[model samples]
Target chain A: MSSVYVHFFSVSLDGFGTGEGLSREEPFGHAGERLHEWIFVTRGWKEGGSGGVDDAFVQRHDMGIGAEIMGAGKFGYPGWENDPDWKGWWGPNPPFHTPTFVLTHHTRPSIEMEGGTTFHFRDTSPAEALEEARAAAGGQHIRIGGGAKTIRSFLAERLIDHMHVAVVPILLGRGERLWDGQEGLERDYAIESVSSPSGVTHLTFTRR
Target chain B: MSSVYVHFFSVSLDGFGTGEGLSREEPFGHAGERLHEWIFVTRGWKEGGSGGVDDAFVQRHDMGIGAEIMGAGKFGYPGWENDPDWKGWWGPNPPFHTPTFVLTHHTRPSIEMEGGTTFHFRDTSPAEALEEARAAAGGQHIRIGGGAKTIRSFLAERLIDHMHVAVVPILLGRGERLWDGQEGLERDYAIESVSSPSGVTHLTFTRR
Candidate 1:
């Protein structure tokens, strides 16, 4: 079955998926590369890196994903919309080889970048966006790529079937938090945790 | 050396130490026993319980500790001060066998309970209260007994030397959170994580 899920999403111990003051120069803002340091050192990232448990998890980002739903921030920096030449953060060939939907207030025409990825912009609610992405997904699973707000919206509407959150051991105290207004959300899911030797804990929430 | 630390403090994956609407009947509030089920099944808590890593960690609550600093909410329900006869939620023999300081504006006389635990009320800052607790510790160690707010205050001031936060699998979307205004709090400490088989990840932070 085609499932809607999130994988390899890294967050700080304080629940921040990303930090404040985001820009083109600092994609993760003051958080820099700290939240993703665990994945960056994995064998999937470097040729000579250790292929341990961290690498084993990082290798699942692309699994069976046929489509992706991302927020505007993930597509580009804050004001990238004004720059007509802004294709995306990914130079020519993006990481996602599937159809990607970018949720934003200002809609734009679909831009087919290099490789098999295409960026489709839309100004709609999470449910509406999911409907479009799911169709584009064919029979494969849909991955929720986030800047935190996008993920929260999907969770609020109870659309996520599975989620994997990597909790890095840093304190990015003042940023986009992932747990606000989510009281009693655990009732619908069975959550489990696994701590890696690299000092990060992976929390997996599978819908019950 | 005698250190200032926190031990066996359980929090949800969202970083909440205690839930909303804490009362005498529901000490952990809406969270109920879900946040502490990991410790309750430990050998240190009950007879014939599991004596693995979880129990090994739970048994350290009273080891090498002399005094404690807690928030008013942890001492009793919200309006506990109105009832002068209210000793505490811990009954006659409270678990704490040391001089415990309760931070509150309504100062009251010290009440010496059974098991050598004394409840002392004081309206002071974290530094001032820690100084008194350290003295009462008698050169042993001081444990930070919390209700989330007290621990946040201590963290804001960098007064803690060691901390062990158990990340339980459940999510208390609405409650007193443990991380806020603590940006870059991890810089001063070396952090590590270990996931127990009981579905709780223990996070330890030691001063660098």
Candidate 2:
């Protein structure tokens, strides 16, 4: 059965998926590259990075993932819609070798990037976007790429079937928070947490 | 050397030390002991709970602690200051077998309880309260007893030397958040995370 899940999502101990003041130069903003340092040291990140637990988790990002639904924030920095030629943070060849749906209020033409990745702009709710992505997924699972708000929206609506969040042991203090107002979310899921040697705790929640 | 630390502090995956609508009947409130279910099943919480990892962590709550600094929220329900007769949530004999300084703007006369636990109210900052608590600690380590706000206050001042947070695998969408405005706090601490068999990730942050 095809499942909708989030893989390799990193959040601070304070639960900020991304840090404050996110911009083009500082994609993760004040959090900078701190939140992702664990994965960056993994074999999946650098050419000679270690192939330990971190790498194993990083490798799952693309496994059996046929489509992706990401918020506009994850697609580009704020105000990216104004740039008519903006593709994404990723260059001509994005890592996502699948049909990717970017949820934005502003619509744009589909972009065919290098490899199998294609960016399709959609101004739809999570469910609506999931429907289109599921069709394009070809029976494979869809991944929810997030910048906190996007994932919160999906989780709030009970749309996320499985979620794997890597909790980086840091405090961002002031930033966009991942968990807010989605009270009683635990009732629907069975959650487990395991710590990796790389100093990140992976929290996996599967729908009950 | 005496160190300031929190032990066996349980929080929701969202980083809420305590949940919404806390009162006399429902201490953890809407969370309703759910966040502590893991510890409750452990021997440390029961009369004959297992002396496993969970119990070992829980037992550390009193080791080498001479005094405790707790937020007023932890002392009692909201507006507890108004009730002059209110001793605390704990009956005549509280678990804190030390001088417990309650950080509250509304100061009250000291109340001595059984088992060496004494409640002293102080209208002072985290630093000032720590100074008083340290004196009472009699050269022993100080425990920061919290309900989230108190710990955040100490973390904001960078006064806490060590912190042990037990991440319970549940989401309390609404509550007093523990990690607010302490951005980049991880820079000052060397953190390690380990998962206990009872299903809680113990995150230890020792100051660098």
CAPRI level of candidate 1: high
**All candidates: CA RMSD in angstroms?**
1.5, 1.8
> What is every candidate's C-alpha DockQ against the true complex, given to 2 decimals?
0.81, 0.79
Off by over 4 Å in 2: none
Write down the lDDT of every candidate, Cα atoms only.
Answer: 0.88, 0.87
Point out where model 1 deviates above 4 Å.
Answer: none
- Cα miss at B185, model 1 (Å)? 1.5
Worst 10 residues of 1 chain A by lDDT: A178-187
- After superposition of all CA atoms, the RMSD between model 2 and the true structure is 1.8
lDDT of 1 by residue, B1-111 (tens): 678988988898888888887888898889998998888899999999999889888988877898999999888898998989998888799988899999999889999
Model 1 residue B122 lDDT score: 98
Strongest candidate by DockQ: 1
